[model samples]
Target: MPYATAPDTTRIAYQVRGQGTPLVLLSGQANDHHWWDTVRDDFHPARRTVTLDYRGTGMSDKPDRPYSTEGFAEDVIAVLDDLGIGRADVYGTSMGGRVAQWVAVRHPHRVRRLVLGCTSPGGPHGVERDPAVSTALSDADPAAARRTLLDLMYTPAWQARQPGLLGRSTVLGDPAMPAHARRRHRLASARHDAWEALGHVTAPTLVLHGTDDRFNPTANAPLLAGRIPGARLHLIPDARHAYFEEFRTVASPLVLDFLGAP
Candidate 1:
C-alpha cells in the first residue's frame, strides 16, 4: 500500500518484500506487482525485492496523459527516492525492460546492474506481437483481454498447468484505467524504439529470453546481447515468452546466480 509521488504528482503504488540489497522489479505492460507473486520468494532472503504498479495499473493513481517509457522510468526513480534507495539493481520484463534501459541510459549511477527479460531493443528489428493477439487485448470484455494476454504470454504447457491464471485479470480491468490511458499506453508501446539508445547504456547487463517465445522472438535476445558491451545472454529451452512462470526452476536459478554472483 505504499505510494510514491512522481514529479507529475501521480501517486504510484509499490510493495517491498524480503531484505537485502535493494532490487527493484518493473513488471510488463498490462501487469502489476502481482506478476511477481509466484517468484517473490525465490530471490535470496538477503536481497530486497521491490515491485511496483505503474501509474495506471494496480493500486496506483491513474493519470490522463504522459504514459511514455520515459515517464515510467521517472516513476521508478520516484519510488526509489521515496524509499531512500540511492542505487539498486534493476530487473525489468517486457515493457519494463524498455523502462530499465532508459533508466540505465539516463540515470546510470542509480542502477548497479540490469536484467532484461523477454524484452527487445525496440527498433525496426524489435519483435512485434501478432496483430490478432494485439486486437484481442484491446477488446471490451475483460475475459477476452485476459485470454488474449495469456495466449500471447505463455506456452501451451504453462497454460495447461495454470488454467486459472486469467482470473487475476481483474486487476488490469479496473475501472480506474481510463480509455485515454489505455490508448496512450498502446501508442507509447508501438512507437517505442530504443535501439538508438542502447549504446548509451553502460550498466553490466543480462538478457534472458525463451527459445519459443511467440510474443517476442528469442532471436532478439542475441541481437541485444551483441549490441550491449559485456552483456550475457541466456535462453531457456521449451519456454515461451513468459519463461519466468513456465520454467521457474531453470529461470530462478539462473537469475539468482547472475544477481548473487560476486
Candidate 2:
C-alpha cells in the first residue's frame, strides 16, 4: 500500500517482502509487481525483494501523458529514495530491462548490481522479433487468448506441469489500465534507445536470455553483455521468453550467486 512520488508528481506503488539485502524487481511492459509473484520467493529469506507498479499499470497513477523508459527509471529512483535505499541489486526482464538500463546509466549510484533478462538495448543495434511474433503481440487478446500466449512463452512440457500459470506469468496484461495507458506503455518500450549509453553502467551486470525466446530473441543478450563493461551473458538453453519463470530452477540460484546472497 506504500507509494513513492515521481518528479512529474506521479505516484508509483511498490511493495517489499522478506528481510535481508534489498533487491528491486522490475516487471515487463504493461505488467505490475504481481508479475513476479511466482518467482519472487525464490530470492527471499536471505534477500529482500521490492516490486513496483509502473505509472500505467496496477495501482500507480496513470497519466494522460507520454511515457519514456527514462521516466520509468525516475519512478524507480523515486521508490528507492522514498525507502532510503542508497543502492540495491536490480533485476529487470523484458521492457523492465529497458528501464533498468536507464536506472544504471542515469542513476548509477543507485544500483549496486544489475540483471537484464530477455531484453534489448534498443535503437538500430537491437534485433527485432520475427513478424509472426510481432503479429502475435499486437493482435492477440491477452485475456481470451491465453493459450496463444502460453504457447509463445513456455514450452509445451513446462506448460503442462505448470498449468494455468499463463494467467499470472505473462507480461502483456494489466487489467486495471485503460486503452491509452496500455498504448503508452507499448510506445515507451518500443522507443527505448539505450544502445549508446550502456557503457556508462558502473554496476556489475549480468545479461540473461532464453535461447528459444521468440519474443526478444537470444541475440540481444550478447549485445547487451558485450556493450556493458564487465557484463556477463548467460543463456538458458531450450528456454523461451518466460524462462525466468520456466527455468527458475536453473536461473534463480545463478542470480543469487551473482548477487552474493545466501
Candidate 3:
C-alpha cells in the first residue's frame, strides 16, 4: 500500500518484495501492479522486485485528462526516489517499455539496466497492432475480451495444449482501468516517439520479443536494440506477446541471466 507522489501530485501505489538489487517492474497499457503477480515470485530471493500501479489504474488516482509516456516515466522516478533507491534495474513490457524508454533517456542516472519486452520505440516507423488484436483490446464482453487476449497473446498450439493455463494464471483483467483511462493510455501511447531519443540512453539494455507476437511484431526488437548502443536482442520462437507467461521457463531464465541475478 506504499504510495509515491509524482510531480503532478498523483499517488502511485507500489509494493516491494524479496531481497537483493532493486528490480523495478512497469506493466503494459491498462495494467496495474497485479500484472506482475505471476512471474514476480520467480525473481524473489535473488532480486528485489518492485511493482506499482500506474496512474489511472489500481489504487492510484485517476485524473480526467490526457496522459503522456513522459509523465509515466517521471512516475517511476518518483517511486525510486521515494524509496531512496538511487538506481535499479528496470523491466518494462509492452506500453510499459515505451515509458521505460523515456526513463532511460531522460533519467539515465535512475536506471542501471533496462529490459524492453514486446515493446517499440513508437512513431511512424513502429509497426501497428493487428486489427483483430486492437478490436479485442476494446471488446466489451469480458469473456470475449479474455478470449481475444488469449488468442492474440499465446500461440494457438500452446493454447490448445494447455487449455487450463489461462484459468490458473494470475488475473490480467483490470476493472480499475475504465474506458476513459484506457482511452487516455492509448492516446498517450500513440504519441510515444522515442526513436531518435534512444541514443541518449546510457543504461545497458536488453530487448526481448516473441516471433509470434500479434500485438507487437518481433521485427521491432532489433530496431530497439540497434538504436540503443550496446543493447542485446533475444527472440523466442512460437512465443506470442505473453511469452513471459506461457514460456516462463525460458523467458525467466533469460531475464535472470541478463540481470545477473542468481
Can you rank all candidates by lDDT, best first? 2, 3, 1
lDDT, residue 4, model 2: 98
The lDDT of model 1 is 0.81
Candidate 2 TM-score versus the reference: 0.95
Off by over 4 Å in 3: 139-142, 161-171
Best by TM-score: 2
Residue 230 of candidate 3: its Cα lDDT?
Answer: 92
By TM-score, the candidates rank as: 2, 3, 1
Superposed Cα deviation of residue 56, candidate 1 (Å): 1.0
> What number of backbone clashes does candidate 2 have, counting pairs of residues 3 or more apart or in separate chains?
0
| Per-residue accuracy of model 3 over 71-181 as CA lDDT, tens digit each | 999999999989999999999998899999999999999888999999998998788887877887778887787777777777778778886966654435566577888
Point out the higher-scoring one by lDDT: 1 or 2: 2
TM-score of 3: 0.93
> RMSDs, each prediction?
2.2, 1.7, 2.0
For model 2, give the 10-residue run with minimal summed lDDT.
Answer: 163-172
Cα lDDT tens digits, model 2, 1-262, are: 9999999899999999998889999999888998787789999997899999999899999998999999999999999999999988999999999999999999988889999999999899999888876776556576545556667678889878875676656454677788899899999999999999998999999999999998888999999999999998999999998888889999999899999932
lDDT per model, in order? Answer: 0.81, 0.89, 0.87
Candidate 1 residue lDDT tens string, 1-262: 8999999999999999888999988877766787777777888586899888888877898777758888889999999999999999999987888889888888999998899998888869786767776677779997787776676677667668875766753223334556776677666666667788788778889999988777777788988888788899999887876788668899888877788776
Q: How do all models score by TM-score?
A: 0.91, 0.95, 0.93
Between the candidate structures 1 and 3, which one is better when assessed by lDDT?
A: 3
